[model samples]
Target: MEQIQRSNWKFNMILLGMVLLLIVSIIYSITLGSADISMKDVYQILFAKITGNNALLEGFEKGWIDIVWLIRLPRILLAVFAGIALSLSGAVMQAIVNNPLADPYILGISSGASLGATLAILLGVGISFGPNYVGISAFIGALSVSFLVLLFGSSSSRADVSRLLLVGIALSSLCSAISSIIVFAANNRNGMMTLNFWLLGSLSAANWQIVKILAPIVIVISIFFCFQSRILNLMLVGDEAAVTLGQENHIYRIVYIILAAILIGFIVYACGIIGFVGLVVPHIARLLVGVNHKRMIPITILFGGLFLLWADILSRMIIKGVEIPIGVIVSIVGAPFFLYLVIQNSGERRQ
Candidate 1:
């Protein structure tokens, strides 16, 4: 009991530290970008907005107010939520599939979303959904592919890891081929450029509307997963062991995959396909928390938020005037870390 208490205390401390770090990171990140704003003014504006005291805005310029409240805050909040959603989903995917390399995009969801967005941009498909129709189309496409993967991957025996991965790869290749055909056939160069940018990912489209839609979904789903931590832990032990423990791993796996697909669809719709946070952040969290979902989930969420927040900052500041795509930035960082993980895992196996 005393040891359990000590462990709980340590966990609480880590949680507290991460929350504080996130707050600081958000404040610091808001101060970056093309427009110059000091830390003091940033806090003042935030304080005024929170307290509903117009007096605090007395000396602050209107443009600064718009920049801080309208532009940067939404973008930062989106980054925070997106990071949480993607990382949480990634961790869940790895557990469900029993693969260390599994990520939210591993099921071809991102490629499907890209294809939907490509068609929407190049051929004006799904325009009836209004201005954000591309996002809606992408969501539909992602969800569709997720269901297809499950359907095709399942067999009379079971939906094993190898079968699921094979289905995902096959679907991914098909989607990529269709997307290439659309890109080549399109007459509008500008539309193709826009589609390309969206494919690479950007948080520049971040706005209050998106934050409103994304935050609750991420928070609620994350809380739900926390309740399923025991099952997730069981899944890591493989299907046979999970069955012996009176848990049906296949059913839970399907549920988790569908939920993960929903999360990925929303994320792709909101911010396109920002990768690596889902893949890398969970692994990093496991290193610190030892693969227990209860501990790893919250830590992964916090670390993912912090990671992408900084990545977004770098995306803006990397070039003199051009913003690098967040996807590109994440890939640049994630690929090397992935290689290191592969090497480490291989060494462990040899030992």
Candidate 2:
């Protein structure tokens, strides 16, 4: 009992630290925009906006207020949701596939989304969905591929990770080929530029409307997966062993994959396919808290949120007035870190 109590206390402390880190990181994200807003002003603006109280910023200038409320706040909120969604889904995907290399986009979901958005931009196919048509198209692409992967991978008597991965690769290649044909045929520079930006990813167009669409989808999926930690742990131990322990690994595997796809689709719709937060944050969480899903899930979410918030800031401020693509920044940083992790893990496996 004493040992259990001690363990519980340590877990609680880590949770507390993570909460603080999130709060600090959120404030840091708000404070470090291009216009040089102070931390106190950010706090007052946020509090006043949330509470519907103008008294919080009675003396502030109108321009500063507009910058905080109209511009930066929505962008930051989008980043928060995108980060949480990506990181949590990554952790869940790692568990679903029982592979450290697994990410939410592993099964070509990102490629599918890219294809959809590219086609929509270059060909104007999803114009019926209004200004947000590209995002909707991307979501559809991701979900379609996700369902197909599950359908093909689960027709057998057993669940096969490699089979699902192969299906994803094939489908992704098809999507890529289709998208490439459209891009090549369309001789319009503006359309090609729009497609390229969608592929690179950014939060410049983020708004309160997009936040409204993203929040509920990501929150519901994240909460649902959090409770499935037990099943996820069973998955990590393999299907045969899970069946021996009275767990239906194949059923849970399909469910997890679908759930991951939904989350990934929503994220791609929200942020245009930001990578690495899913792949990188989970590994760091696993290092800190072992392979336990319950603890790692939330930690991964918080740290992922923090990581992307800073990444967004860097993307915006790294080159003065010009904004860098968030995807490019993440890839640049994440590739080196991923290589290091690969080397370290290889050494460990050798040992």
Candidate 3:
């Protein structure tokens, strides 16, 4: 009992710490960018906005309000919510497939989104959707590919881990080839540049409109996944074991994959394809807290949010006047961490 209490106490402490860190990170990130805004000014604008008290805005410059409220804060919040969505999807995928290698992109969702965005930019497909057509197309592509994956993987029997992964890889290759062909045949330099940027990912286009759409979806899905923690834990134990425990692993697997795909689709729609967070954050969470989804899910969400928030800050400040692609930054950081985890896991298996 004492040991259990100690564990619970430690978990709560870490959770609180993560929440505070995320808050601080957002405040600090708001102070970055080309415009020079002080922490005091940032807070004043935020307070005024929150309280609807123009009195709090008296001493602040108008530009600071616009920059903080219209520009920086939206991007930061998008990063936070995007991180949460991606990481939770990763955590759930890993458990469902019982493979640490499983991530949101592992199922070809990113490739599909890239294809959709490519078609939209290069050929003006889906232009009728207005200014955000590219994102809308990407979401449609992701959802379509997700359904195909589930359909094909489960055609023979229950969609086992190996079968599902194979289907995902095959479809991913097909999507990538199609995207390449479209880019090559279009011969539009501007379209190619746009496609490259979307493929690499960026939070530069973030605004309140995006945050409003993505934030609520991410929060609701995250809470829903939290309630499925017990089932997720069972999934990691293998299908036979789960069946013996009276859990219908296949039904749950299908549902989880669909839910994860929806989360990824929306995130891809909002921020393009920011990789590595989904793949690495969950493993990092597993290391910090054990494999219990109940404890691990919350921590994964917080860490993922903090990780991306800082990554966005670095992307903006890494080179003056030139913002690096956020996806590239994540891959640079995530690649090393992923390698280390693989090597460490391999060494442990050998031992």
lDDT of each: 0.84, 0.79, 0.84
Could you give candidate 3's per-residue lDDT for residues 105-172 as a string of tens digits? 76787778778878887888899999878777887788788778778866456556667778888888
lDDT of 3 at 48: 88
Return whichever of 2 and 3 wins on lDDT: 3
Q: What is the lDDT of residue 309 in candidate 1?
A: 89
Candidate 1 — worst ten consecutive residues by lDDT sum?
A: 153-162
Q: TM-score of every model?
A: 0.91, 0.88, 0.91
Q: Per-residue CA lDDT of candidate 2, range 1-351, in tens?
A: 998898678777877898898787777677776687788887898899889998888989888888888878788888888888888878877787676765656667777777777777777878999987977788778777777766776546654677876777788778767776787789778766666665788888787888888888888887887787898889899888988999887677667766777677667766776877788999988887778888888788778877888889889888998899898998898778767867886899899
In angstroms, give how far residue 112 of model 3 lies from its true place. Answer: 1.3
Model 1: CA > 4 A from native: 1-3, 127-133, 154-156, 348-351
* Pairs clashing within candidate 1: none
**Candidate 3: misplaced stretches above 4 Å?**
55-62, 124-136, 150-163, 344-351
In angstroms, give how far residue 315 of model 3 lies from its true place: 1.2
- Cα-based lDDT at residue 92, candidate 3: 86
